[model samples]
Target: MPHYYLHLYNDMIVADEEGLDFPDLAAARAGAIENIRGLICETVSKGCINFSHRIDIADASGEVLTSVSFGEAVRVDG
Candidate 1:
């Protein structure tokens, strides 16, 4: 199983730059949510931001993985 890392920003995830890998899209989404949960919590705790935002999913090649819509889709233009 390839490890997926959800690179998060203050606003939204860098869809085009993020790289995630999993046996399926559902798993990837689950992982991404888990990863971002901490960051989201911290941001809220500091009163920096609210609303759980996320990006779809992008491959290592910077291609938008349409199967996932949990956030902004990266590499969509490409």
Candidate 2:
């Protein structure tokens, strides 16, 4: 198990003080997406969502592994 941090970046860096344990990068990525979805859902309920915001998944050493945008967290059926 490895610890990874999920930081929110929307003109600022909202760092996660306590990192989570994930088996690997893929798992971390999925976890980040799931968490972001939950956050977006909450924001959507208030009718306030900045599509430009993003979640940055990073390693313990301040290295960004991957990022998920607010727009990507949503699914719009057209």
Candidate 3:
């Protein structure tokens, strides 16, 4: 198992000081998506969503492995 940090990048940088442990990068990616969805749900009550916001998944050494944009996680209709 390895620790992966999912840092949020919205209006500002929110560092994940306590990282989560996952079996692999794939699992970490899934966790990131899950987290983003939960965050979006919480923000819905705020009446605004920053689609450009993103989560940067990093390894224990702080090297970003990949990123997932809020816009990419959900479907929006006109």
- Give lDDT tens digits, candidate 3, residues 17-64: 999999999999889889989999999999989999999999999999
lDDT of 3 at 65: 96
Clashing pairs in 3: none
Model 1, which residues run further than 4 Å from truth? 1-9, 12-20, 66-78
What are the per-residue Cα lDDT tens digits for candidate 1 across 1-78? 654445444464453343655986668777666655655556657776444355445555545453333233222243
RMSD of each: 8.8, 1.6, 1.2
Worst 10 residues of 2 by lDDT: 69-78
For candidate 1, the 10 contiguous residues with the lowest summed lDDT are 67-76
Top candidate when judged by lDDT against the true structure: 3
* List of clashing residue pairs for candidate 2: none
Scanning candidate 3 in windows of ten residues, the lowest lDDT window is: 28-37
Better of 1 and 2 by TM-score: 2
Task: For residues 1-78, write the lDDT of model 2, one tens digit per residue.
Answer: 899999988657789989899999989888878887888878778888888898889898989989888888768788
Query: TM-score, each model?
Result: 0.53, 0.85, 0.91
Error of 3 at 19 (Å): 0.2
User: Using lDDT as the measure, what is the rank order of every candidate, best first?
Assistant: 3, 2, 1
| CA displacement after TM-score superposition, residue 8 of candidate 1 (Å) | 2.8
Model 1 gets an lDDT of: 0.52
Against the true structure, candidate 1 reaches a TM-score of 0.53
Q: Judged by TM-score relative to the true structure, which candidate is superior, 2 or 3?
A: 3
